[model samples]
Structure formats: structure tokens, C-alpha cells
Target: MNISNNVSSITAHQTLLNTSANNIANVNTDGFIPKDTRITDNAGSVRTNTREADNNGSKRSQTDLAKEIPNEIIAQDATAVNVNVIKTQDEMLGTLLDIKT
Candidate 1:
């Protein structure tokens, strides 16, 4: 009946999506080194880390469209799955209460 893990997963994936979208938006901005996002799991809880790229001394934005696009898609899918799981758990809890009454 615990959904804390799913909630954390959804939060992590949302962060990932946000980072990817930011990278894509800054692709045309010069000297913008897009940040990279990673998901870390700690004791069944999910965490997101966003880090800036190394100073490569390049004025061009190093954000790659090919990678960011897929990353965003994957994040979206992960978020959706966690959301669905949370919804199902809520329904099941409601059903259990109904049975008891």
C-alpha cells in the first residue's frame, strides 16, 4: 500500500524531462552548455541530479539534439508509468476500504 517509491520515481522523471527540455530550448543559444540529468535510486527512493557540462572553452552550445530527444521521450514514458501505478494503488486502497465497510 506504500506509494512513496512511485511518487519519488515520478518526481525524478519529471526533473529529467525538465532538464532535457531546457537543453533543447538552449540548443541555439551560444555558450550555453546544456546540463545533464541523471536518476539515482536510494533505498527504493528516486533522486535526480542535474550537472553542468565541463568548461570546454567552446562558445557553441554542446547540447546534442539526437540524445536529448530520446532522453525526453524515455523520461516521459517513465513518468507515465509511475503515475499509472500510483493511480492503480489508490484504486486498490479504495476498494479495500469499501470491502471492509
Candidate 2:
């Protein structure tokens, strides 16, 4: 398994979670435009980018709390899973080394 790729995926998810949190936090502020997370696949790895959203005059903050909250929760869960996988890999490597010794 490519640990580097897994780490990068976690980072990408983290960026998404942060962006969602920021959007939810500023949901009530006037003239606040929600930020969106964009993911691009670079070869086999992933890259995350955040951008400000365009707004219309009729909109308040351009944030939907209902959607943002669920997205943030999912990102957080995905990050946790990646972390667990890394931990499990490390344990397996350690076991192999122990056997070799």
C-alpha cells in the first residue's frame, strides 16, 4: 500500500472539513460568501483546493447549515479511517520486524 497516498487523501479530507466548518460558522454574517472545497486527482494522489463562492444580492450567506454539517461529519469520519489504516500498517510492519529478529 502507498502510505503517502493515504496520507494525502486524509489531508484532502481535512481541508474539506475545515472549509465546511468555516462556511457553517459564518452562515449568519452579512455579505459572507461560503467557501467550497475542490478535489483534483493528480495521477494517483488527490489535491484539495478551496475557493470563495459567488453570491447573488438576494442570498444571505450562501451557506446551507444542513448540508455543511453532514459533509463535515463525513469528512471527519473518513479522516479517522485513513488514520486507522496507517496505524494498522505500522503495527503489521512492526510484527514483521519482530518475526525477522
Candidate 3:
């Protein structure tokens, strides 16, 4: 049982690290906000063998889909711009071919 708890904690810590890394990666991103992973003891459990993120406070906002919408839009816009650039290049090539023929 102790081994299982230890493994669970380790896994939680790894997840925390990944979240931190992703936050750091987007630190310079416009309107990008960093998120923190919190592990808390479950009060309902007798032994409380595991921890979870407390979603009662500001942490609750971290996982909010509303907040993520803007970020998703920004990413999509960036992708669209790249696609448009590629399409323009293709169109230009086609135009050049038309002139040659």
C-alpha cells in the first residue's frame, strides 16, 4: 500500500513538472498565463492515500475552459496564417506557370 502511494505521488509530481514545462514554454506568449499544479489530501477518505488539485480557489480558474478559449483561438489564428502563406505561395507558382504557357 505504501509503495502504491509512493508511486502515485511520483506520478503526480511528474504531471506537475510537465504542466510547469508547458507553462514555461508559453511564458512569452501573448496573454499566456502560467498554471500551477496543487496536490491536496482528500478529506473524504479514511487513509487519504492520494491528493488532488484543490479547485476551490484561484486554482479553479486554471482549468477553466473559458480561459483556454482565447489561447485556443490564438493558436488557431497562427496556424491559419501559416496555411494562408503556403496557399499564397502555391498560387504564385501557379500564376508563374500560366505566364510561361
Point out where model 2 deviates above 4 Å.
none
Q: Candidate 2, residues 10-49: lDDT per residue as tens digits?
A: 9999899889988999989877888889877899898998
Model 3 misplacement above 4 A: 43-101
| Tens-place lDDT digits, model 1, residues 2-72 | 89999999888889899999999999999999899989999889998899967688899888899899998
Candidate 3 CA-lDDT value: 0.49
Where does the lowest 10-residue lDDT sum fall in candidate 2? Answer: 52-61
What's each prediction's TM-score?
A: 0.92, 0.88, 0.40
Clashes of 2: 0
List per-candidate RMSD values in Å. Answer: 1.2, 1.5, 18.9
Clashes per prediction?
A: 0, 0, 0
Q: Tell me the whole-model lDDT of each prediction, alpha carbons only.
A: 0.91, 0.86, 0.49
Pick out the ten consecutive residues of candidate 1 with the lowest summed lDDT: 53-62
**Residue-wise C-alpha lDDT for candidate 3, range 16-55, written one tens digit per residue:** 5455556556645555445655544444221212333344
In terms of TM-score, how similar is model 2 to the real structure? Answer: 0.88
Query: Regarding TM-score, does 1 or 3 come out ahead?
Result: 1
Which candidate gets the maximum TM-score versus the true structure? 1
